[model samples]
Target: MDSFPLGVAPHSAVTIRFVEALPDPSPVIAEIIGGGRSPGRADRYCAGPWGLTVVVGLAADATPAQAAKAGALAAAALIGEAIEEAVCAIALSTEASVAFARAFRARLFRPLSLKRAPRAEDLCRLGALTLVAAKPKDAARAWAPWQAIAEGTEWARSLCAEPGNRLNPTTFARILGGLGDLGVEVEVLDAAAMAREGLNLHLAVGRGSATPPCVVVLRWRGGENDAAPSLLVGKGITFDAGGICLKRAAHMEDMRGDMAGAAAVAGAIRALALLKSPVNVTAVLALAENMPGSRAQRPGDVWLGHAGKTVEVIDTDAEGRLVLADALSWGCATQKPRQVAALSTLTYAIMAALGSHYAGLFATDDNLASALLSSGEASGDRLWRMPFTPADDPALKSEIADLRNCPPVGPPDAMNAAGFLRVFVPEDIPFAHLDIAAMTLKAEADDTLPAGPTGFGVACLVLWLMAKG
Candidate 1:
């Protein structure tokens, strides 16, 4: 009888457990009185977010004083349980959790911890049982599903927060290689392998870094009957220094989070595996670190991509698109997925345009654009569709090579980057480019979810995959 209940209880007494030892008696009171709005019982109640303890009433037809006592105890026990779950799940060191519980009045609200703390079982338990009285069944069932999503999102954020030295290209490859054991077929394409395949643009960007670049393909085939898989490609710059067109050191610490898109894709695959969905999903991640070394590719360098298309490197800072160009081509060529979606922190132009509230999606095909827009909305990771017609494609044309890595610098940089990626997508194929630079790591205090390495795209992608059929 560890679980709590929603709706009205007929009993007079309730009990809850406080799992952590406490230094002080921080009490929370939730007053839910009046069986169907009786005069003597209190009308409203308040308690700390998910605190512990339960109150007792002298039956459903109790007096005001009896109901009050019941409410107080119930609120305390319930709030205590919530606090216990929150602190335990955050796996905070005992001292930190103790301090945090006291400061926040652990008998009340459950705040998310800073790191992967205690087991997520409490979260799963909380989610499993929580339900609005008016919509009990549906609400209760919704909990476990979204709880799983939250778990995956947290994993993705952790990946982004990790330092470059610990999780570079080779390590990333090895990590993804393990997914093969989970029914994901992984292919790691290193610098030499990519060069042999004529992926010169992807190599040019990695040339500046000490760690070699690698393109990783993770394919999950749950669709035993399906003919074509859905493809997702992510720009995985383990670190970005903007190469020859170097970025200022100020705020460059955030560059480690540049690989947020790749982390997101990896997390999405993990979610799909957890959910055991029926869709065939393929994830491609191009892992590299953009560094400014003597061997770094300079501006004005030209290189060939996978589809035999040459690109002029006008700004080595635009390396995300360069690596993604090869990834996009590789995905389209090998998988020939029914649909292709690529994501990257390609430009600040998106932030300048749409800010942090939404991702900018550029699609060559209208149906794919519509599908992504709808899916993004449903998952709470919204995307605003941008135009990418042939007229807009002209901006990326170069006099030196088949195309320039960047477009005429201006207002529509995000859209132009999408148009650039579209150049490599087969004409008849459907494709969408997601500019996630702004939405990935941005956060706010009042957000439904906290800031710092927001795993923004993983949910939307999983939802998209789930809805594909």
Candidate 2:
């Protein structure tokens, strides 16, 4: 986690002067504001009293997202200049000022960099953040939740940023073990434990890899001991080589981020612990590496899941739901939580439907769906609700098994995958499935984060859990 030295700066610190609603520059910004017509935009200038200064502007109707972007642009300009400490001179609302402060975290977007040299223009590469606001205390108050959310988001992104070689199943579980230090009771179930518990579907996926798979359960008991907890399940496929059904060599490297869903769950748990929120959460992460090794499970193989349901493997590439099925079943049956939500980098079908901007959401409960939708809006990790297919759906039928992992031929793979998972959970519990296929990696930076891993579900999950309280 990257640390921002809040409210600490030297007298000669660099200045990021934000001129909100600027028509003609006043004496405050005249020396620094270059020729830029629009407000809520970054201007072109450096070399002020402190050495390097970047001036920005904001409009009356500007959003916090806009504020962050503007601040990011300013921060990007100061990246390689070696300007150590800086004060944010912004005359905006408390929300906007806090958003402005978002530009300075060391690990916002560039999650993990094995790159031997420094990056060119990552905004999070900035040094210090001291917000000069109308009411410093008010700004601090507004920044608190966002800071926690940002920390969670950065944690998830860093996990996603790791390459497959560096983040195999064992290493991944080891990395998450550190969360136990944060008061989140973390338990890892290796292959033997999972196999004993009838997690066959999950074990099958990792049979190909030398680094055996595991299931990590994190419990954060912030609420009463007797309180019914909310459950989160993540499909942690550290690397998806598509098993025997191999993917094309082109862009196959991007599959290293397939475990983003698990990363998000861990990140959310970390955030809740940081806030010390009065809510209980049990997160079940199904960790595996799907490789096409000699011992890999072949197509047409059937596995008896944790819930005693048999699923025929139609396509090796559709392995996410297989792991998730046992995870959802084990988590729901063990914890017996109030509500349940599962996330995965599931299918290309959902991505084709919602694009990279929004995850495909499938839910059984209206309230859960509504809360998630609202959280997506508030947290900027958007979701579009999609219908979950039924168990009796003709495409899911199999000759020898209870169901097929995926349809032999399909356009609605996402819907079928969600339905397969829903069969494992008890009917009374509210359930939601987030198919976050294409949102994790990006070719370029967006309003909130830089390119690479966007930390798909953390911020939204944290805010949703907070609202649950």
Candidate 3:
């Protein structure tokens, strides 16, 4: 009777009646609530992985402080149990937001695993330990581990939610620059410099925007070895108005999320550095705003990529792959990373295929694909490998350039985009592309995770890098 009980099934509702007196509580509160006792609320409820519900009373004369403390303890009990299953959602209560935040952080103090749920003993042991503080709208205690996760998630949401004007390339660079304190060496390369390095594709995609383009790179050298690092290239279009081939206004505001892949990369670097993981990682973020002004590259244009290969512009909306092409070519040619992988919110086909839950991964190497598959599943940021083959390669063919950056036509737009990117990869080097259009944001919030900005790829990358370490 003293232990907390979980609802029988997922998201099943259980009501607890707490009043000044146990006897008075049932009839009076029940009349106001008009509900029968839920099946698992009684003292004799099952006690295996889940135990009986604990009922604590806050007297009618209780101060807000006392109620807050009771609420924190109650919330902690619920959240701690969720840590067992590695997932849970909390419906916010007006009076308990602060208390819930406090309790949520408390759950992480125990041997909680980000990779997955903890064992029963660890979960039970954690459920019993309590910080037990009286709370009245006090700021929640800064739980370092949870706070880092939270900051990255919240950062993603904020960046994604902002209007395009509020978050252009300069501001994007500033955002990366801000993370320097977290040990990421941030560098912002302007259009002139990118031009000097022959980043024509990046410059071509960005020319129409008045915002001026910039490429931000974040480097983290945490590993002991001075080996060639694994590179993560992100396609960062700060806002894609679709250039001369303008996107419909229906959901254009969501274009702010076009940079989400970059955000994921930055957030991953931030988390790795915050956790002080021993892995050397570098992120090449190509930041630009794709608009349809007179100066923008037209449909027939052909831009030279970093590897000195030309890419024909079949569609201006296929801009993400353009920026990523330059970034990948640059990262591979200069950085010479042992393995190169890039992430992007590139194509709508991925959204149609995987819905809004998973990322589409394209890899030339089966081992990298398998490793990412395992890491992604373990971290809750799942990725499904879509095909990138010789069969699909012809779909991206062009007469003017070495290859086109988009498919002429297909239901498998995601695959073609990946196929387009394959042209930039060196024959001997291994590469992968993550189409994260669907996985970057979530519709609702959860206890261990915030709602809007899921920071989907961050956890998977961290887990992968740690495994390498």
What TM-score, computed on C-alpha atoms, does each candidate reach? 0.74, 0.90, 0.71
User: How accurate locally, in lDDT, is each candidate?
Assistant: 0.67, 0.79, 0.67
**Residue-wise lDDT of candidate 2 within 1-469, one digit each (tens)?**
2242211111112223333322233433565444434334544554555555566666534577777777677665555556566555555677777777765452233565453453654323344565556666777777787777777777788788777877878888888888888899989999999989999999999989988999999999999999999999998999999999998998889998999899999989989988898999999999999999998999999999999889899888889989999999999999989999998898878877788879999999999999999999887789999998776887788999998888888465788888888888999999999999878887676555556787778988999999984
Best of the two (1, 3) by TM-score: 1
Task: Kindly report which residue stretches of model 1 are placed more than 4 angstroms away from their true locations once superposed.
Answer: 1-82, 86-137, 389-393, 407-412
Residue lDDT tens for model 3, 27-118? 33333234443321211112222233333344434444444455444444454353332111122232343333333433233211222454
Which of the two candidates, 1 or 2, achieves a greater lDDT against the reference?
2
Tell me how many residue pairs clash in candidate 1.
30
Query: Candidate 3, clashing residue pairs?
Result: none
Q: Where is model 2 poorest over a 10-residue stretch in terms of lDDT?
A: 4-13
Question: 107, model 3: CA deviation in Å?
Answer: 14
Cα deviation of 143, candidate 2, in Å: 1.1
Error of 3 at 376 (Å): 1.0
Best-performing candidate as measured by TM-score:
2
Q: Which stretches of candidate 3 lie over 4 Å from their true place?
A: 1-147, 410-412, 443-451
